[model samples]
Target: MIRHATTADFEFIFELYMHPAINPWLLYEPMDAVHFQPIFQELLERKVLYVFEVAEIPVGMCKLVPEEHRSAHVLYVGGIGIHPSFAGNGYGVQLMEAIKLFADAEGYRRLELSVAAINEKAMHVYEKAGFLKEGILRKYTYQKAEDRYLDEVMMSCLL
Candidate 1:
C-alpha cells in the first residue's frame, strides 16, 4: 500500500535515505539522524512524502510534488527508493504502479522524474514503468562529495 508518510516513519525513512547502497542516488547527503530530523519534518510539513508498505511495514519511499496553475496536471516524482533488502522482490514495479494510480486518482495527467545518467539500473526501472526518456539535462546535479556534476536524464509518463 502507498500512503502518506507521518512522523512515525522517521526511522524507516531515515534508514532508507542514509543507506550506503541508496544514499548516493537520493536527494540528501549522508547525515546523522539528528541532522536529518529537520529535513524529515519539512517533508512531513510539505505532505508530499509517501511510503510503500507491505502489510504494516514501509519498504519504500517517494515524493509526489504537484505543480500549480498551468502545470497542475503534472506530478514530479522524486526521492524514490526501495530498501535494498527488498530490491529484487518486484517492489519497485509495485511502487511505480501504485504511484500511477495515486497520481491518476489525484487528477495528474503527467508524471515526471529525473534519474542520474550513470544509474542505468534505475533508468531501466523507470523505463519499465512506462516513463520515456525526454532528454538529458547536462550537469543537472552536483555531487559535492565527488566534486563532480552528473548529467540527469529527464523522463515522463503520460497517464
Candidate 2:
C-alpha cells in the first residue's frame, strides 16, 4: 500500500534512499544520515513523498510533483525505488500502477518521468507500465561523486 510518509518513517526511508543498489539512480548525492535528514524532512513537509508498504513494513518510496505551468495536467514522477531485497518481485510494477492510479485520481492528463539512460531495468519497468520514450536529455544528470554526466530518457504516459 502507498501512503503519505511521516517523520517516524525516517530511518526506513533513509535506508531505502541510501541503499547501494538504489542510490546511484537517485538525483541526490550520497550523504551521511546527518546531512540527508534536512532534505528528507523538507520533502515530507512539502508533502510530495509517499511510502509503499508491504504487510505494514515500508518497502519503497515515490515522489509525485504536480506541474505548475500552463500544462497543469501533467504530474511528474520525480523518483521511485523499491528496496533491493524486494526488487524483481513485481513491486516496481505495483508502484508504477499506484502512481498511475494516483495521477488519474488527481485528474492529471499525463505522467512524466526521466530515467537514467543506463538504467535499463527501470526503463523496462516504465515501458511495461505504458510510458513511452519521448526524447533523450543529453548529459542531463551529473554525478557529483563520480564527476560524470549521465544521459536521461524522458518518458510519459497519458493518463
Candidate 3:
C-alpha cells in the first residue's frame, strides 16, 4: 500500500535513507538526525512524501512534487528508493502504479523524473512505467562527496 508518510515512520525512513546501498541514489546525502530532521519535517509539511508498505511494514518511499506551471503540467518524482531487502519483489512496480493513479486522480497530465545515467536498473523500471526518454542532461547533478558531476536522463510520461 502507498500512503502519506507520517512521523511514526521516522525510524524506517531514516534507516532507509541512511542505508549505504540507497543513500547515494537519493537526492540528498545521509546526515545525522540533527540535520535530517528538519529536511524530513519540511517534506512532511509539503505533503509530498509517501511511504510504501507491504503487509503494513514500511519498505520504501517516493516524493512527488506537483508542478502546474504554464509550461509544465506534471508531477516530479524524486527521493525514490526501495529497501534492499524489498528490491525485485515487485514493490517498486507497485509504488510506480500508485504514483500514476495518484497523479491521474489529481489532474496531472504528465509525470516527470530524472535518473542518473549510470542507474540502468532504474531506467528500465521507468521505461516499464511508460516514461519516454526526453534527453540527457549533461553534468546535471553534482555529487559533492565524489566531487564529480553525473549525467542525468530526463524522462516523462503523458497521462
Task: Report every candidate's CA lDDT.
Answer: 0.93, 0.90, 0.87
Instruction: Give the true-structure RMSD of model 2.
Output: 1.0
| Residue 64 C-alpha lDDT in model 1 | 93
Best by lDDT: 1
Measured on C-alpha atoms, candidate 2 has an lDDT of: 0.90
Candidate 3 per-residue lDDT, tens place, 1-159, comes to 678999987778888888888887778876887788888899999999999888888889999898766845779998888999989987777788878998898888888999999988888888888889999999988878788899999999888
Q: For candidate 1, what is the TM-score? A: 0.98
Query: Alpha carbon lDDT of residue 31, candidate 1?
Result: 93
Judging by lDDT, tell me the better candidate of 1 and 2: 1
Full-model lDDT, candidate 3: 0.87
- lDDT tens per residue, model 2, 66-133: 88879899988975999988988999988898889888888999999999999999999999999999
Order of the predicted models by TM-score, top scorer first: 1, 2, 3
Number of backbone-clashing residue pairs for each candidate, in the order shown: 0, 0, 0
